[model samples]
Target chain A: MERETILSVRDLDVKFSLRGRKLNALRGVSLDLYKGESLAIVGESGSGKSVFVKTFMGLLDANGWIDGGSITYKGEDLTKYTTEKQWLGIRGKEIAMVLQDPMTSLNPLKTIGAQIIEAIELHQNLHGEAARKEMLSVLTDVGITEPERRAKQYPHEFSGGMRQRVVIAIAVACRPQVLICDEPTTALDVTIQAQILHLIRDLKEKYNLTTVYITHDLGVVANVADRIAVMYAGDIVEIGLCEEVFYEPKHPYTWALLSSLPQLGVKGEPLYSIHGTPPNLFYEVKGDAFAPRNPQALKIDFVKRPPYFDVSPTHKARTWLLDPRAPKIDPPEAVRKLATEGVKGYA
Target chain B: MPENENREVLLSVRDMSVCFGKGKRIFKAVNNVSFDIFKGETFGLVGESGSGKTTIGRAIIRINPTTSGDVIFKGQKINGKISKELDRRVTREIQMIFQDPMASLNERAKVDYIVSEGLYSGERISEEERKRRVEKALQEVGLLPEFASRFPHEFSGGQRQRIGVARALIMQPDFIIADEPISALDVSIRAQVLNLLSELQKERGLTYLFISHDLSVMRFICDRIAVIHKGVLVELAETEKLFAHPLHPYTRALLSAIPLPDPVREKNKVLEVYDPTQHDYSVDKPSWVEIEEGHMVWGNEKELNRYRDMLKA
Candidate 1:
């Protein structure tokens, strides 16, 4: 089945000149987003997951520049459209984004309802009574009670969960084709996090919108992601169906990520964390970015970057271990047990 | 209970209650919260936003005044219009590490001054002694000795937290209250800080009132667990027992809510929110009752019996 592609990114490269040194934030990262499918980009901090998404929304700081890449949305090149007028039409209308901190994204002076209504009016041609009516409907749809009164309430008046809900209401107010959520529930409590995830999932289905969820927490990605992209340093090391990625991971970095997850039933020992910090992006890498941290790194892995080796029809990983000539290796016992019990058949 | 019964009791808080505002519109932030932190043991306080865990931590260090309650340290009450002598004693014995290191630490103050601030108040000490203590504290937290001259803004989130810990530990406090110390840190740096805290606790025989919303981190570090909801102490039990078999419904709900790292368990598990309305708190008076050895739950006998029956079913 060939799904219609909503957005296609090719050879996206972002670099920052910090203290006279050029730091490559995103290096030749390419991916496709189909309509109504949720894609999760998983990595530790400084993996450029946030940078890639920020580029799409034109929210990157002045120091960052796209050296080479094309982000095509509906066959239109987004990188070339650098004018504020072009961005104003696309942002918060065709595509909306929700940031990690709800408080910062929301206006402190304005009421929650008023802020959402502003977004509605800016994108959609709703005005006065019509905008108010639509704002109430959107608030109610996002599971917020007393839409009439809450419309008058400010951001500080609502709890963390309620504020996030208001943020969601505003994001979805214009019926955006894509929602870029960057760690939307990271700061929230677990119960509230669950509600937010459920709300995002429900809204995605109701509106038939594509979603790009960026987060460090694999637990969040497991429940929501249809496909997962394992990013390291500034590159996508692996991309696969969620089930295959969780069950039979080919990349050593992906295996490490799986083992580090703390599970409910596993009781023998503490969760294993990936030792050593991620490599500095300021320096250029000759080979694999994860080779320094990967315990099973081969000589070829250090000298030359491995091409994406196909593991299955839907799975591919960038590692020398996936090569036919390379020595076979197995994931740690803890990860295997977790895969068998918890993560297998995730798709 | 006898006053001088056990030397193992490092800090005891009795009937601690704190209220904001006054008169008819008063809000009880903390209600009759009483718990003991043993010497050389980590006491975990887990709760949500409005649970008053932070308030309890603040009250113990005298950062804020308690409405009514005795914060007893080494068998002496230190609360309600404290004297300078008592304040000095409390400051020496108890220290606090705040959640946001950037906000807690003075941006303009150099690392040397920040670390020496605690020792500065104690007694007159030579410059050589101060330098030695500051260097030792910084080294203990894995920071460079030369960093003592740098300001807080120069350091990363993790390094700033290490500075915060160094500042608190230089006083050599018997009991330390860490209020969500690692919540602001990066995930990779979190384990490093936790390991450092654990190592420090073992070396110094320090008692910690570790307050955080993270159950997994608490499970790893804390010896005993106390669950607070709203303004009430809901449950208190040993860490292993609490994680293994949570008795209180709220505790169970909280435990289930922790998002496990495993994708499989994460998918299969359904975390339920804690609803106070479901429980019957109709009893005119409620008290803490021992459900088992070393496990205490707050509720009336009728409610306990009902809960027990429900669990059995």
Candidate 2:
């Protein structure tokens, strides 16, 4: 489907003023989220996956500010957004964020109904009776049965799964164009997680939500993401369609991440662990940030930064190995088999 | 006979139940759970949070008192209040590694003191001997000698977990109750910790009552597994057999719910949602029944026959 890009991020750079030093959290990160498609931003802690989304929503902390780049949503550039007036217009009305923990995201004192109604009234022009109706409808739409009764109950009355549903209900109350979920299911049980994933997928179709999912769980990514953005060290090392990134991965970092997954069922076989820690963000990053951990790192990888090389028309990777002049080296045997005769052939 | 059957039974739990609160508020967190761990094997207790898997681990170590049933370690029943001599014997034979290393380790204490906490109780070792044992325990968990002086805050999550492992290893216990040791660590760190654990187990010939919500990790490490749901033992079998042929509805649902690393399989997967209402358990009381050789399922006569037919088919 050739859908219109709902949000187009370009040359995005974000930094935080920690202590006396300026730490670059996101560098040259770009992504184009399409209408009614889920884009997953995957990375470890401090990889700037959260920072990238926070920038688009104008939710970046006080110490941190956008260094450069533009996040073009609708006709507005989100980078220029500052004042409470501008952020209020965009934050929940245009783009809504669902964090990992629902407890912190929700107001414990207020009832779930009040929160949803408040969000709806703030964004849409619904008032009193109409607002209550809209809020209840949204609550039901997010698969919360008996919306009337649930609305009267506090967040504490609901289970973790139900609370998350209420959180989703609140996110969709304003009927935002984009829904940004940051590890929403990491804290939930696996069974509950499946239900939540199903709920989100249903909501995406029902509301035509352009969803940007920030998670480290590749399995969850495979199920929901139409496209996958593999982030490493404040950089999007690879970005492509879910199929392209999984089956025909071009970046060595993507390969390592894929191989490190524990669900392969290769019993008793020593599982692969990615060597070395992520580059310290305190100092200036030279060349490829992953080059130190890259087993197939070339001499040029240390000296020069690799540009995004095209694997396919839709797929690109930022690794020296992707360069035409670089030596021909295949990913590990497991990853090679995954790229070729792999489960990508299945669902 | 398999080697497990012939080998000495390390720990055997008989109809153990753990309940909390009183009267109307009474809740049985673990209900009549029975399972056995053989020598030098990883016995996994798989369940979701609040399912009482953690409670079972705690009950075996006598941390949370078991309301009913007996716990036999090395053919001797050890449950409830016992003599100090018996308590010391139990303490020496078993040790526990908690889920959160940060919370379990005292933030104010140094690494060496935390690791050698078990020794301070009964053992009358000299300062030199204590230092040597602590260092050896730290080394076994893949920590450095230099780490002994630093406080808990100084080490990373995985390193802190290693310290937790070192604390447990200080006693050199035959059995270790590892309660979700690697769940908190990052993926890369998880593998490193798991490898370290497996290496330590092999080196010491250790028996682990490995408890975790992550079935994927359980499959990677456990020799045998028992699935728990709402404080009841739903299924028990060898890891490979359990994965291949899950009999209970809960076990099947749990398996299908586990997202695989493979994108293709994950994308095409049909997730099985297990609902308790789907089963007709009102007619006959459900209990643990051996459905196949070395495989147990918690079900009534009707469910067992259905499971048997399903297996035959």
Candidate 3:
């Protein structure tokens, strides 16, 4: 398959100024988001997964700034676009973001119709009736029944699932080329989550928009993502196709996350939990940030950082254990079943 | 789980209903829900957000006021039947672990004082004994003794959740209502907290009314599960039985919706949507019926017969 790269991010370094100290939120993060494909960034909280995606939209906090690297979108360097006015031209029309909480994302006071129509008007040249027409169709497009009635209603009148639909409608109003969902279904129930993921996938195909999902739920990532990137301590530890990451995962952090899944354990048995929490991003990370908690950490892992080792043409992982001289280790027993299932295409 | 006749029922909620507002604006959050938490077993209550799972958990611990129906603790009808004086002393045996550890724990108060708050209200104890109990609770939750001097704000989200667990364990309560304990935690930390809860149950013989929306987590921890939808009991059975043979449409829909960790399986999976309108309950009001020997499901005549056939097939 010939892959079309919609967005190329190279050695992106994002830092935040904290009380006179500099905290690097995203460190040398690099990846390509193929057109019309969903790439999920899976990691724990504060792993810089959100920061890595937020750079694409220029939505970083006031104290934060892009320390280095380039975000090339349609031949434009987004990192160099300093002014909010410059961002206005490409923000919603070219790139849109779907946040986790719909309550904050959607306007509570305004009618759903008014919010969607306003977004449509901002990006498109559609007038009163045309904009309103587009807004209602978008609401319907996102799988909300009775688009006319739903548009007239406020956010409180809608259920949690319906509210998320409204948020999606607003994001896709102008039909952006790229849709970055930051934990879009984390707020929704399991059943509603499936509904929303299906809707997003359908819309992604319809619009030919590239999808980037930032989430902690591995289940959601597996269901929605085409490619997977494992982020830890602001570093992209692993990146590959969804099957490649899940079936033949290389990083120890990925193994730890997979083994920690409660479903992997039997009744009355202890779960495989990682030893410690993520290191504080306040201080500069020395060597591998995951070494202190990683069970298979080598002596050199504490002294020097590990570079990316190619597992396959599509898959790559960063770990000292992947080095040629390092001792071979298999993924834990709890996770080996998952790999086999992925290989066989079913359990 | 042991035999129904052999095992003791720690807490039994009969027709427990929790209503919000009144008159024209009235809404029944939990409608005539009934279940039993057996001794030394994890009793899981699962449903979507508005399904009133949290409301039922609150009612059991007496945090939420009950409008009607009876909540029988041991052999006594405790809900709305007990006087204020008896309520405090009797309800002390029931403790609760909240979803958000940050919001539940006091930011200003030290860990030791926050944990001993329940003890301060209960039977009087010596200051030295109180210190010993607090230390023991912290240690049991896998925190160091020095952490007792620190405040809630000083700890991370996962560590603060451990503090919340420690606070509940300090009471040495018979039953604990774990309301979405692991849902608010990170994926990497969820297993550790879940294991701690399981250990506490085994070590202390504590019965847990584990309330969560995550089905897989429920399957791993709970011995028995009750599926609730729109404030109504849909199905109640043993964990393995319920997962394998989901009699209710809502339960089946929920099961199908959960995206498994395996990618190929997830990609091939198809979810069936459950619509309540498809069910015609006009002829007969849906009531809890024993579909099999132990599995119970709420349905009218049409659904009841269909569920039995589905179970067989």
Model 3 lDDT per residue over B1-313, tens place: 6776678888888888899999999999999988777888999999999899999998987778898888888787788867876687565788899999879999889998998899988879999999999999999999999999998999888899999999999988889999999898998788889989999988999999999999889988899999999889999999888888888889889888888888878888978789989888888778988788668899998889888788778
Write model 3 residue lDDT over A136-188, tens digit each, in one string: 78887888888888788999998888899889998999779989899999999
Which docking band does candidate 2 fall into? medium
Q: Considering just chain B, what TM-score does every model have?
A: 0.94, 0.97, 0.97
Candidate 3 segments whose C-alpha is farther than 4 A from its true place = A341-347, B83-85
Pairwise DockQ winner, candidates 2 and 3: 3
Error of 2 at A219 (Å): 0.9
Per-residue error for B15 in candidate 1, Å, reads: 0.9
Model 3 is docked with a DockQ of 0.65
Cα error, residue B162 of model 1, in Å, equals 2.3
The CAPRI-style docking tier of model 1 reads acceptable
Clashes in model 3: which pairs?
none
lDDT of 2 by residue, A292-313 (tens): 9987889988888899999888
Candidate 1 runs further than 4 Å off = A259-276, A294-296, A341-347, B1-7, B81-83, B279-283, B310-313
| RMSD of model 1 against the true structure | 3.5
CA lDDT of every candidate: 0.84, 0.87, 0.88
